[model samples]
Target: MAKGLCALLWLQKLMTELSHSHDHIKHIEVDCHFIKQNLDSRVIQFPFMKSEDQLVDILIKAYSTLDKLSMQDIYAPLKGMDGLKDEDHRNLIGGVVGEVQQHFPDASFMVFNFGDQESQSQIPELLSDMPVMNYPIHHGDCPILAMEIIHHFLRAADGWLSLDEHKNMLLVHCERGGWPVLAFMLAALLLYRKESNGEEETLHLIYNKAPSDLLRLISPLNPLPSQLRYLHYIATSNVHSEGCLRYKSLTLDSVILRFIPCLDAEVGCHLMFNISGRDPHNLTDKTPTVLFSAPERGKDIKQYKQADHKLVKVDIHCPVQGDVVLECMRVRAGLEHGETLFRVMFNTAYLLENNLMLGLDQMDVTWDRQNQYSRAFSAEITFLEMNPAAS
Candidate 1:
């Protein structure tokens, strides 16, 4: 719905020009002018309609709502069923297939399973009535792999759903712990299809579909920021291209944390960072490396004493490239352990203005820690250099 009003106006103008020689052109032009005047005078309003409530879809496409499906088992009885008989699982899947087929007698079904490898492997046998594609997504980490999965899923889903036939139905399924990745995938798909607009709106809309505790139960670390970063990637990506922008090497000069949350009283709040991603030095490894970690071995980084309006700058000077994950953690007093305060993930190729500024609302944090930080809390990453050849 980005520039929705402009698009509507353009359509009206195009229709008017198409019938310029006809007598009806005069009526069309007058109607267009009327619409503009009413819009300007606040007599007419165009509100954003959710994807489900878009009535125009019925006029353009088939009347059935069975074209796309989303299945997230909130209770997740099927997950971790190592001891359950295979027949039991098959019966459960068969019941779902029976229901869908009963509802749309002429429809064809395709299943996209986002789960563990073992669980995904069983999908084909369980639901032999349709085609099943497995996309195993690792949780807790590996943002690079997740991005690749998203790109592939978007392309595959778009190709299948764009067919001229009316009976094509797609069902996206995920297990108990797969909600985080599934949410990200669904948001990316919605944005790709232009059914939803804007990164935050699209992402939050998908997450809001599930129960409030679904994400927190699956992931200890809030994955929204990292997911939002990928959503932005999808928004800016070219549909005809093989992939996103080419990877580029860059130097992370420093990170500035504003409104640092106070965890300790005496020594103030000690902070640490862990930045990991595909190596800029060797891209073929496929394994992410720790590009940077503050308070290395015996060294100590600066701490912010006052919790209010405090800014702490940590110099990184680390070389990184392609799908980076940056995590900020608060170190406890006299303890080696530190808890993650927030995380930000992004690709070097997608950097704009040579920096990334993330506010408190955008960064991934636990619910308890969310309200503790000020609304102005932000993390700014500044890059010192970029490879000219790669750019």
Candidate 2:
């Protein structure tokens, strides 16, 4: 995978040079340089693989003939069917199910629909004989909440997939604009089954299965940071455990923003923070609470000048537990609305250090121009204390 990624980076670099557009390469420039340095120093090398033998083809290219043939046969009945109409959609689904039954007579099928109630109801009545589970998820949903929901999903999905004695088939369906949640679920399943290891890589691989612009079109704000955070949780924690996962209590002392980005206003920028997480005091409440919000009502919003200093500090001291999401936004002078500068999400149960530091590339930024912020743009979150608890 490392070699494949290196090859991809090299290709991206070449494309950027040919197109003379640096926009697409900014995010990966550091990585490309690192890979180049390693190669120059003979520390690492990418061995060439024949096109026919390249396993990465499964991820980047179309499926093999056998796999495509199987899929076509199962979904042959739905050929040329219009997907926009409700009647057509229902018939298409039913026809596909009928085709599946014809192809695999003894196979048991399960449908997991990641869509809203309205979309779930659109499932054909013909599938009444098969098990259909509905798990509705909205766009830009809270990562912590998504984590809990994914836990339940993994339990049920894994149970069906593990039944080796019977030929079981799992069909995952999602409504329009449900790709984010669907991608996250697929990545989690890969990690749970030990088929993939790295959280970022697995998540990116799944998302790359679709068009590059699909995610941006579906979601305005970048969801990868929060998604990656949850992916890290899935990779590190034991989701198969019987009870709720234990989380340690921690206090966020302060946030230090270094090499702050230059804003359009001359008066600098007003920084507002919103920290949310599972209720530390109420274990039964599954909903996340706003642990802290800066610039309280009637209180003055502090403005920090980027040219004055290299570091900006915001004291939070908010108590948080379980999964935590910290978001920072920069408001221009005289403007009520603010753009999110970056977001960080993590679970207290997996905190092995007193502080969490993230570089520019590691965070989710709303801006497109990376040159506006210094390469040193980063955030450091200090933890005052952590109460160690059993896993």
Candidate 3:
């Protein structure tokens, strides 16, 4: 009777051990399913390795008793596998500039501004030795100056930074680092990644790498632009003559002119111009008084075609030394001088060409139209040159 009782007790203990083993197996399956779901969604990947080979390697591979136990303790926490989180690098939150500088000491920064003259004037002093490029509100009249600033930065500065031997160079803006800055950053990263890694990869990243929520950090007074228009031009425009700035439907009479001096390199800025006319269907090369030049066909006064409704182009070449002047000769149908505003549009492509110098803004005068040179009015204004600290 005693012998039979002892045998029954041993069988019961074996059964309990098997039940625990089955529960452990079920838990592992649940963890793996979660990981697979994340991976399929392009969220993350798992680096595979046996737990024993990982933190527990001390036990199996080590000859020393202390090393074996140490490895086991380290690996103990990692026994339950888990998924990794995604990285959002572009969010501006919590003094990220300071944190980035700590990792990349030699990182450089550039600040571009047109509307913020006072703040812009002070940037060079604040970020000494770093570059600050400014675009003046030119012609006091045109709307397309924004596009000119975009092209210059991308073609000249964007390409050269990677080769500058600086590890952590950065470009920072105030509340609204949208439009111009975003386009450049995206293009720069895309170009960098393409050169660093061949096109083929297991995954496509960067679509959501920028942190959206952190934009709340910018003060309400400042807001990023809604769309990145300059990059849109780079991705779309036709190649025009060396010094020719071309765009579709250029309402030459209503363009704005901005004078930007000392834009960094040959293409130190980006420019955009758009024109429109009545007879909506006849908006082509023959639209009259509109200028279009192409390198292949040489110079020709062309008419706008029905197809050329919205023309766009960019010039990377920036004239380093000279004055950019703009003048308008004509005003729309019926409006007083002060009542109607005329925007003078100039070709930035022409401005950035090598060896070209612009002395002043010009407007072709007509008896019925007013020209800039003919004006008798005069006013004194203080002009600030390059950023003081940059000097």
Candidate 4:
């Protein structure tokens, strides 16, 4: 009887161990099901690792050891500390500029925004060390000036920076306001480096070149007018200046025009004028009217297209110098009498600033219909040589 009783006690102990093992196995199965569901739903994507191809050397290989140690240090009193919790790297919530600086501490930053006081003020707050450049409120004004600023920075001082440039020009912006600017800026960069053919051509490359999912991430910011001019300028002069003023400009207006490859190689500019119409105000009967010599065609008398539309083609050739003193005979005739029309101040100065000295083909004056010059005055110009010719 005593032997039989001892045998029954051992059997009972074995049954209890089996029961505990069954419960532990069920718990593991439940955990595995959760993981499998997440995988099916794509909530969890396992990163592929080809390094060494060792199971023991996997990313989570150290997890088992370090995790246990880490768990031991976890405070039991903390809320929800009883179960295993999945973690990911997506928890990082930092500013873009800040994150970039974390990786490349010495990287230079230039923020392009709407230039409103509110938006610009945030830049210094985010990056205290970096400087700021405003795109200016150019409603109908030429945006080439703005585009030039961007093209200069991306290409560096010598205009040679590319995808593999010495210092990477990591483009970043906060929110979505600067999407249009970014689109133009990036397109210009790609064109400058010759990584792509033309603006629209390169823009397509930007769209198709990206990964499918990430490609959809871009905002369809329409190309700006200034950006279009950049394309034209690039296509025309291919002004790839490998000049010495390689360092970034200090201000938006501080473009190193001397760095244009063609201009940089020359002493200055050579100028030859082709004025189509005599400025109406200049009525000096005795004054010698100048004649414009067309390179392809012979000289023609400067006059209105049909004596109705007040349009004039000012085809200037820089055979010697980029600077040309434009004397609108019509305007001069207006000035000598009373010095009244401030048209010269507005029209002449702006025309020079926006479309002069960079080897432009011509400045076509769309004279003001109102006869005030300021009301309807506009100039359309082209580059001296397209990018192919310049190259």
Candidate 5:
């Protein structure tokens, strides 16, 4: 019973930490005070960072720095931070509050639409040293979109601040500045670090390294469906792929049927795909859509029926089936599946183009044994449209 009470207290503390309302003790403003008090009492020396320089900027409400900083110079004061220095530290940093932009003359904010563009004009007047890119992307597009904005800022400038030079840094914000902006900055930092080490800062590196939870937090605001889909690809590559398969079926009718081949493994997982809805003859309705993590052959699949099955369904429907694109990335695998690799065979009666199967055909399946929670796999399957009349 004593342990049970402790557990409850711990849970309550966690709940308090997660809460958003700032006015209540349940929200625990004292937590910060406690840290400060401990530092002052010599109980601990909490590294005190002024609001302007706090690395975890997402938690705070706002910040105003005296001058714009290059990415490298931004870390000058933070050099002694215990866990922050190494290239391996892919830790997320956010501005808890909207920052007061000051100094840089040409720096400004940009969003997806005209309204955002207009609002950003007001930002340049207050502070113009840094480009404050506020692209609230869908959880999926956050990283890539953030990269594009960063590159734009760099190319527009005379030169980029080297990580060692630390002359200037980018200060970015999203609604809360927690997940979307956090993921993008961390991933970009990692890429920047990799490039400094004489390694290429490729899309694969950023996508493979950034945490999945960070991407999920900002998925709703993605400007383009493709950006979100690319995120799905990255997350899938990072997770487990067991008994994962993709299928595409086209009918003379408007409906295109795609099936995920059932796995013998009793594993739980999420499968995401990029699907397009189009008319075979019209070529006008060729719009792409997304289907995220619908369950297949598992208990969650059963639960899907009790709730809204549509929430888990990754199907795309169109009036006619000119072409159907199917892709799958594995999110998790069950223990029942002893191995990480599995074969997928398409049993279609119709004839279709084989080159459409995979842009690349090599399937290298590997497990990150350190994370028993996931095993990653990549495979390619060809899709072709045979004569429906034969069926």
Candidate 6:
């Protein structure tokens, strides 16, 4: 009984921490949410920065000094920090949060010295009188997006992007979705500033997506549907080919939430029209739309409930269970037109019945030796067009 009570108590605490309103936490406040570093210095000024504004100095200066900064500079202040300095840039961003493993690590508030060249390790004889400032990044926030924004600023041609002019760019939008939108604006600038890629690649990146899906989700530039589909919240809609699979459309869980039950302002449209200097004919509408079939058109549409049942191929081996069996299934809903829509979902109740992890997040077959998902698994429902009827 005591052990059970302890377990219950632990669960409650975890729930509280997970659901805590970020607004209540000042760190998660719009201005500080993006930077994960915790700073608590008492009026101790570096040679190049104001006492209280050391972080701003570090951030703005970092842009100009990125090419000059060595691995030693990034970690000089984080002395006691574990982990190798050579982690990938993605991990490097997470390192700011201190917990590198979590997709969204907990926010951190820390302070380390800047420009302590004498104390700096890993730098043999690199010379620098470069200005250094304390910078902050939130581990709990999206670091990859943050990195992209930083690079965008560095690579941008506009004088304003240099922070030398737009000194307060970081504080532009300090609201829930606003800060992220600022990042998207930077990222979008990076994409179109080149004015490169073909239309298909552009749409694919927008709808199908990239590692920086967070930027894509809240942004209002999806030109594919022109309107968000309201009824069915989402579909994988992946087209498979060539010994490997990739999403043809930039679609993901983050993308699904772009439009749904509710949508906020047209921040994306604003960026598209104003910053990019592009006409906003298609990306401006801010609401998800609905389509209803008219009775007149319904008579011409033939629906096939059952087209065929194709087993979902796992493309993996599973340890066979004596009495328990699992099967992959597929169902097709053929519309009156040429397009055939397929709905696919897990067929077994075994997962829920046994309290196993649903494994919904992993898009491809996963194999693990530990935890509930030790067995490899992945399944999908695909839709394709058959034959076109003359209009």
Span of 10 residues, lowest total lDDT, candidate 4: 247-256
Off by over 4 Å in 2: 1-85, 95-103, 116-126, 136-146, 296-299, 367-372, 386-391
My TM-score estimates for the predictions, one after another, are 0.72, 0.70, 0.31, 0.31, 0.29, 0.20
Off by over 4 Å in 4: 1-93, 98-114, 117-119, 129-151, 155-167, 174-177, 205-226, 242-391
Tens-place lDDT per residue, model 6, 1-391, is 2243356556445435535655567544443332222212323221333322333332233232222222122222234453244444235543432321131122112212112222332212111221222222211121112222223332432334344432322211112222233333333333433342343343343332223343343332221221111001111211111222211211011001111111113211100000011111222431212111112133343222211111221122121111111212111232222211111112111122321222323211112211332223323322222122310
Model 5: ten consecutive residues of lowest lDDT: 58-67
Q: List model 3 lDDT by residue over 1-391, tens digit each.
A: 2233355556445444544565554555565555445655758633444322233211111112212222111112233432111122122222344554543354455554333433434435544666666543322222223343445544444444445533323343332223223323344334333332321120112212233333232212111111222223344443222343443221112222233221223221222222221222243322222232112221242222223323312222211111122322221122222111122233333332222222222222221323322242221111222232432
Best by TM-score: 1
lDDT of 6 at 351: 24
Which candidate would rank higher by lDDT, 2 or 5? 2
For candidate 6, the 10 contiguous residues with the lowest summed lDDT are 268-277
For model 6, the superposed segments whose C-alpha errors exceed 4 Å read 1-48, 51-158, 163-170, 174-183, 186-297, 306-391
Model 4 alpha-carbon miss at residue 250, Å? 30
Q: What is the C-alpha lDDT of each candidate?
A: 0.68, 0.67, 0.31, 0.34, 0.32, 0.24
Q: What CA RMSD would you report for each candidate?
A: 10.0, 12.9, 22.5, 22.5, 19.4, 24.4
Write one digit per residue (lDDT tens) for candidate 2, span 112-196. 8776545436653547777988776542243224456778888888788677424565666666556677788877887887777
- Per-residue lDDT tens digits for candidate 4, residues 274-345, read 332222223233121332333322235332222323333444432211112232222121122211111110
Q: Order the candidates by lDDT, highest first — what do you get?
A: 1, 2, 4, 5, 3, 6
Task: Report the Cα lDDT for residue 140, model 4.
Answer: 19
Off by over 4 Å in 1: 1-88, 117-120, 138-146, 267-269, 287-289, 295-304, 307-309, 386-391
